[model samples]
Target: MAIAWYIMYRKKRFDRSHDTEKVCPRADNHPIRINGSDSSTVLSDSNQSRDSPRTSEWSNMPQWLEGLRRKRVASACGIPKYSYKELQKATWNFTTNIGEGAFGPVYKAQITTGQTVAVKVLATDSKQGALEFLTEVLLLGRLHHRNLVNLMGYCAERGLHMLVYVYMSNGSLASHLYNEKHEPLTWNLRVQIALDVARGLEYLHYGAVPPVVHRDIKSSNILLDHFMKARVADFGISRQEKSALHSSSDIKGTFGYVDPEYISTSIFTKKSDVYSFGVLLFELMSGNNAQKNLMEYVEFVALGVEDNEGWEEIADPRLEGKFDVQQLNFMGGLAYNCVNPVSRKRPSMREIVLALSEIRKPRNSETYRVITEETTFELDLQGTFDSSLTER
Candidate 1:
């Protein structure tokens, strides 16, 4: 009896040691905050204990309960991770596609809360992969501005991923600019849109904590709200300025709107975005799509011209001579400087904002303007383009 009791004690001790030695390999798979400062509530797959497999843990829980647990975990982080079923029901069983993007198809849906939102689902064979999708969610989750699109939630389940955003009633800027079905944007409205986009870019470049470079900036990526206010959207390819500068990633952007310098050098910077914005400005002015040889058209008109001499020729014919020619000349010069082959010559977004504000100011209202920057020079609003206009 004494020997048997001693054998049982030895077996119990061995079992405890064996159990303690086992470690789950996927413990590091848990979702982490973007800042990596905390290990609190996040929305990744739950970590299973060494004693149980993840399949068993999930299989033991009811489907609805498992979903609720996910929602709660994600909600704690201020960004909810939704289930595929919830999104399917909201999006009318995935039949409400409103648009398609490089990442995937976008659908319009009204959630149970009666809030209308745009859902972007990742396509199986899309060029944009899981990394891009996660980048957008993490970046947009924290970055917020009046000019930037707002991210509402996300869905990652059953080998699917999606992002939700506030619904823009007026659709994209491209629709109004090119689609005859929609009315053309007015001159004043166009100027306002330009300022809106500039402000958005300015915020990303300077206002954000570490600064962000919107690698893709084009008319289609700019959305308009119910008030026709323009907001920059589609951050799938965006990157923080620091990471972008250090990364050796392939160049990503629309063809005609891409920075010429970036294509040759394979180095994308904030100035690259400025170059794209310059193209957008020209597109707005000419009422031409950038993909359709818009740059060639501008080059033809600007070939031998010094100072905005022939800028009037590139004006959108739809305007029918209603726009102020001075404004046109000034905008053309500003845009030309933005697209300058030398990226350093391009004006910063802050400077662009100031210039646009000056352009927006009524000519008769104030001739004397307060100069904020230490080294400030004036561009005669009434006169033609001056090289010093965009110069520091």
Candidate 2:
């Protein structure tokens, strides 16, 4: 049986690389001895032979793979080389799929260390490739803030590009808002989440060396940890601004959340992120999806305001007289300013942060209630606008 196995292995080697004569006896059969070590004990079927000396052929592996291996070794000393096959096994053939995004499918992986991680695999045919991957790696690699998602590491082996990120237990804010089973976010919690997101954006825009513009900012990209604290995720579309020369080649972001000025002019700025933040603010206040059919409602409100009419009817039904009217109005007003047709008119991220911060301050109870009640009247007037002429 050993001799027959040797013959088959020889034939396989010759077929694989036409190097049968170079093959060692131990390579062809289990329990075969090489350098006084049993082949079965020294190496597995999937890994390179431990007994085999490093060969020149090993250098012929893909450059990206070699670079990634070196990086992994430097970052994590004493860790075993995690080959693609090993990763496949760790992920159970990539069967336990968690979710798919613009990048690709993400799977939950349990490594040998017993630590669980989310593995984001990039599709080979994806329009965005190593560039996006590099963007994420470069940005997240340097950023270690609690408000920002942590990147565990990445894999670039044999055309397979994957990123390993710290898994968030609660998923994304978008899931919480859209998921039917999930409870509606309380006003205070919503404000807190908004504040957390603001701090994240502030960190990126101000804390970094050269300000970073989060070209894409939406509920889906805001991940929540076990404590429900928001962490900004998905830096694929993010870019650093040095001197205002437009860096991005394409206008990439979710509709309704993207800044109108940035979309029209193809220019990315911190204010663009602020605009998106405004949309998020609206989402939180109204308890409504920005992508929903709210154009008519927005237009009606704009028109009503233009004609000295009210707009309380368009307010989110879920709030149901529970929200502080003053805060709600401030939030709505901020959202309006954020989505303003002119980019210059939009509030800066700092301003947005300040405005949201003010909502946390104590206010006169009677005045607050009055402002809250008047929202209904204002919303009613907003419903009368000419739907055809309103800008969404």
Candidate 3:
């Protein structure tokens, strides 16, 4: 496909904000959107259907990414259909409520085989509507990966709707970070989780033939299994981004995590996910409630990268000086690239995974300076990124 001049890029944009990937509604279809608020409700990607009608949004200009290729094909996965009565029995008539939101209450229950699962009850009158619900079922039913939450079954019985998922015993990453009851995550654990999320996003953006845009990627959306492995959850607002500029203007996302360019142009691409993930990366490093907005904080750190001033000041105090200086610095640089004001400048999730894989713990304090002092990764960022993207 030939590259069309990007209307969004023509104006030349700077000053970006961090927010989740979201869509504004199109002319014909008005789906109820879920806010990207933080929720520790484990495996609870509720199809919460309260009808909050969003205002009409600007139609994003058709901007074809330069040199970007689109490859996609249709594929289907088999999913079991469960009776509402069976689910009702499993949850004792919605008695074991673990979490609740716009999608309705999520109940922890047991099926006949004595397996525990999370049942997200969807509201029939939800703004998300039937089409979006079916899309979630079809999408989640077929897509499976260790880093992604699995959809076990569904119940479209009577006037009630629900989705069944493998239970996430360990809960969400947010619960571990902000919640004082849980222990603070070690630096190594944080790095590993970041890698897991990067791979998951890579699969969605590149693994899928016609890449699926996880319109919503945030800390709350990342669930941890019993093994403490991170699994990307919540396809409540996900959709496929075909080659052409999308016909609909349906932007959906949480406030703090949304990309600035996405807000300016209303044109979302795979890089939109990259921006949100950048915020997540920053959140992991700072160990703060990033949903409150981290643009200023990220900028503050990015500006300090030259002399390495205030590195400790920005790092999560919870770390207590236990982390490897090299590892922290490397991850911080990667975060800066991901959150680069220009979406095109952000490193691809594939690149993020490779970078993390290459960054290992330093041998000892004797070799720490040599390992951490090298700006090899920074050089690569400059070498690989489009120079124009770095220009204001």
Q: Which predicted model would earn the best TM-score?
A: 1
Tens digit per residue, CA lDDT, model 3, 1-392: 12344644543432111110122122223221122111111111222332323321112211111001111111112456687789999999899998765566789999999999999888655666555555676556545556788888877657666889999998889889898899999988999899888877766665443456787888988999988999998887777554213544566788778877887777777888988898898899898777665768777656656543344456898889888766676667667777777876676665566667655644443112111111223323212234342312
Deviation from native of the Cα of residue 143 in model 1, angstroms: 0.6
Q: Could you give me the TM-score of model 3 versus the true structure?
A: 0.73
Candidate 2 off by > 4 Å: 1-66, 69-86, 247-249, 293-296, 305-314, 365-392
- The CA lDDT of each predicted structure is 0.74, 0.63, 0.65
Q: TM per model?
A: 0.78, 0.70, 0.73
Cα lDDT of model 1 by residue, 1-392, tens digit: 99999999999999865543232112222232233111111111212222222332212223322332343244312566777899999999999999998989999999999999999999999998776776676567666677889899888777787888999999999999899898777888999999889888877775554567999999999999999998999898887676667546577899899988888888888899999999999998999999999999988878755543567788998888778777776788778878888887777776677777778766753132424342354444332333454444
Tens digits of per-residue lDDT for model 2 on 129-215?
776776676556555466788788777677787888888989999888888788877777888888788877766765554456787
Question: Ranking under TM-score, best-scoring first?
Answer: 1, 3, 2
TM-score of 2: 0.70
